[model samples]
Target: MNAPAIPMIFSAHRRTLRLTRARHRSAGSDAARFIAEDMIEDTLERLAFLRHEPARALVLGDSTGTLVASLREQGAAVEEPAALDLEAPHPSGGYELIVVFGLLDAVNDLPGALIHLRNALAPGGLVMTHFVGGQSLPALRAAMFAAEPDRPAARIHPLVDPRAAPGLLQRAGWKDPVVDTHTLTVRYASLDRLVADLRDQGLGNALAKPAAPLGKTALARARAAFAARADADGKTAETFEIITLTGRRSLAGT
Candidate 1:
């Protein structure tokens, strides 16, 4: 008998992980490594404060292996899965904790992803997810939108509203879901620099239907509008609203 084929719908999503690694390698800076380090430290601190003992953890979208490395250091058996969509069926065994950082925005099946995440957790297992949401980079979004007003296809990816994320967790059968938001302010010297950052972060707009490119006149106008909003210090302020959602598998069902 032939072995069953793995799902094909998730293949494209998995390629995103490879793309993320390429960006990090091409950057050749400590930036990616540093971001991973900071993420792990913050997560560990949060877990400690909650008096949680992590025995087995799964780090979703562990592109660069930073979080997985840290969890392994803490003596927790860690599984770093590269699949991005999370549409596949959950594994039979349960994980004590699941950490998903910076992946949901790119996943096509957000609701299905959450369901799979919940199903993978053991009774009372906690799931922590962090993603960009709610008016993040509005200035940039506005500029891009204005650049090619005729083409709505050029609009960036739709972000989840922070206010609605907690409810999504609950609807997915998680218990005690909580959602919180924070803004990351990054100052750039110019619009070009900001665009560069976005590219390096693998955040370039991937709209299925992209708007037409802005003509020279429109591009100039958009640039002027962005710089006009720059701070007195001559730095453009880019805001990324990060939504952190946490929930636990219902103990009553398991």
Candidate 2:
């Protein structure tokens, strides 16, 4: 029997456009890079703790460029491709280390992507990927709901739940897979700032069929709803849960 068809919920073209726009924004101005920085830091720490040194590494979705520099400083030959389609098979393989920053969350066939990552690695190679998890953006979600309480649309892209990651890794044939999650909290004075930050960090919606833009009245309602949840300091707290998945290819190349 043929495998079940993967749902086409996300558009690869839109995802590329979002990333391109984010790169342009970052180049023209000092856009917020806290998300990428955090992922790089966490990845470096994990590499250090495990004492796993790689002679060759492939880094993906590293908008900040710091991850590549750091890896180079460690004497590793790193490849930072200008563009790569996560849903398709990688052009090159035999990487000893593969680190992905943010693209996994937007891929339509996540399990297939994971399998591709595993296939790209050499025997005993390590793969680490970090992306926003399902529990993130409660404040933004609430505000979107308030924008169209009666006829809400699908504005936010669905995220991966940490609970389902292990099964995905197993299906991908990863050896010694590990799934971990942590939350980052940020305080925003307004919903606009929050949305801007998300766009700056390349976390914009990449759904195949995005909802129509909010009108003036709906936007006002969203702003008001967000402001209503502000704390005494006149800022609303927003949480982002980052999920990290790490695993190694079997020595037998399975």
Candidate 3:
């Protein structure tokens, strides 16, 4: 029997467009990059702790280029592909280490993507993947809801849940899989600023069916809703939960 089809919720083209726009917006050194920086730091720390150095590595979705530079500094030959589709099989394989940043959250067939990543690795090779988790962006979510209280649209891309990652890794045939999560809290004075930060970090929505842009009245409502959550200092706290998944292909090449 044929397997069930994965839901077509995200558009690969839209995802690419969002990333491209984010790259353009975040080109300057002064742009917001807390998310990418955090992921890179955690990944380097893990690699150091494991003492697993790879001769050849593939780094994906590293918009800031810092991760690639760091890996090269570590004496690894890194491949930073211009474009890669996670939902499909990687063009090449036999990589010793694969690091994916911030792209997995928008993948529609996440399980399949994991399998592809695993397949692309050589025996005993390591893969570290990080993306925003399901618990992220509560403030933005609330504001979007307020924009259309009577009929809310899908304004945010659904993210991966940390709880489900281990199962996905196991199903993908990864050995000794690990799932870790950490939250980053940022205070924003307004909803527009929060949205700008997200765009700067390539966290914009990439749903296949994007909601229409909010009208003037709706924008005011969203701003008000977000402001209502502010503290005495008039800044709203927003949380971004980052989930990291690490695993290795079996030595037996399973």
Candidate 4:
């Protein structure tokens, strides 16, 4: 894919998301769906098998605060970053376990970011991450096109294709890197609600230069297009393909 040409994500965009964390926490239990609490829970399940429970863990994006809490419940010490800028280089060494949630897609340099994550781990330390991936939001994309058939603006951030992930992991020097994806389908009553959920989940526009919001007339068309695709249940379907990655700092050295 032509990833480099696309300004994947702006650092400032993430700061806004972090600032809104309180709003997400107040959205009630159902907010988990938007904040990806399920994915964090799923990944946490695998921690049952770790022979070494991490004493110093760094959590990159736990907007929901679920993963960090879960780690703490295991009697492990967990710390979170005050601000995480995916475009910048991080310190080379610290932390034994790093569990990232919902932050990778906006990164401008995937390879460098991955290298930083690998380097952040102490020897024998592990890094696990999840983010929305390539096969995501086809319905929303179609609606955007219908909104402005003549000239559709770039609204969505460029996402990582799972197919290209393994090679990237290896290139970053993560030993025995693993990458996989699972699809989650959600149905929305209207396009507006979908957009609201995205904002509530900190998945709002993170592009370096975001397009202007749809004009009044264009929005009407996009809503109509979205309604046209609704199933008999009268809800439009949107798919999110969650990609998971895991790698470790090797005792044997890279």
Predicted model with the maximum lDDT: 2
Q: What is residue 50's positional error in candidate 3, in angstroms?
A: 0.7
Cα deviation of 185 in candidate 2 (Å)?
A: 0.4
How many backbone overlaps does candidate 4 show?
0
Q: Which tens-of-lDDT digit does each residue in 205-236 have in candidate 3?
A: 88989988999999999999999999999999
lDDT of 3 at 173: 87
Tens digits of per-residue lDDT, candidate 2, 108-137, equal: 999999999999999999999999999999
Candidate 1 residue-wise lDDT, 1-254, digit = tens: 99665432323433474456534653576333333333456677778888777799888755456668777888899887555346656765488899986667666566778989888898889888876787788788777766667753444677788777867787788888888776777777677777666555545554444456667888786787678778899888889887778888888644
* TM-score-superior candidate, 1 or 2: 2
Q: Give the Cα lDDT of each candidate.
A: 0.70, 0.93, 0.91, 0.80
Q: For all candidates, what are the clash counts? A: 3, 0, 0, 0
Task: Find the number of clashing residue pairs for candidate 2.
Answer: 0
Name the candidate that leads on TM-score. Answer: 3
The segments of candidate 3 whose C-alpha lies over 4 angstroms from its true place after superposition are none
Question: Candidate 4, clashing residue pairs?
Answer: none
Error of 2 at 58 (Å): 0.8
Can you list the residue pairs that collide in candidate 3? none
Worst lDDT run of 10 residues, candidate 2, spans 21-30
Candidate with more favorable, higher lDDT: 1 or 4: 4
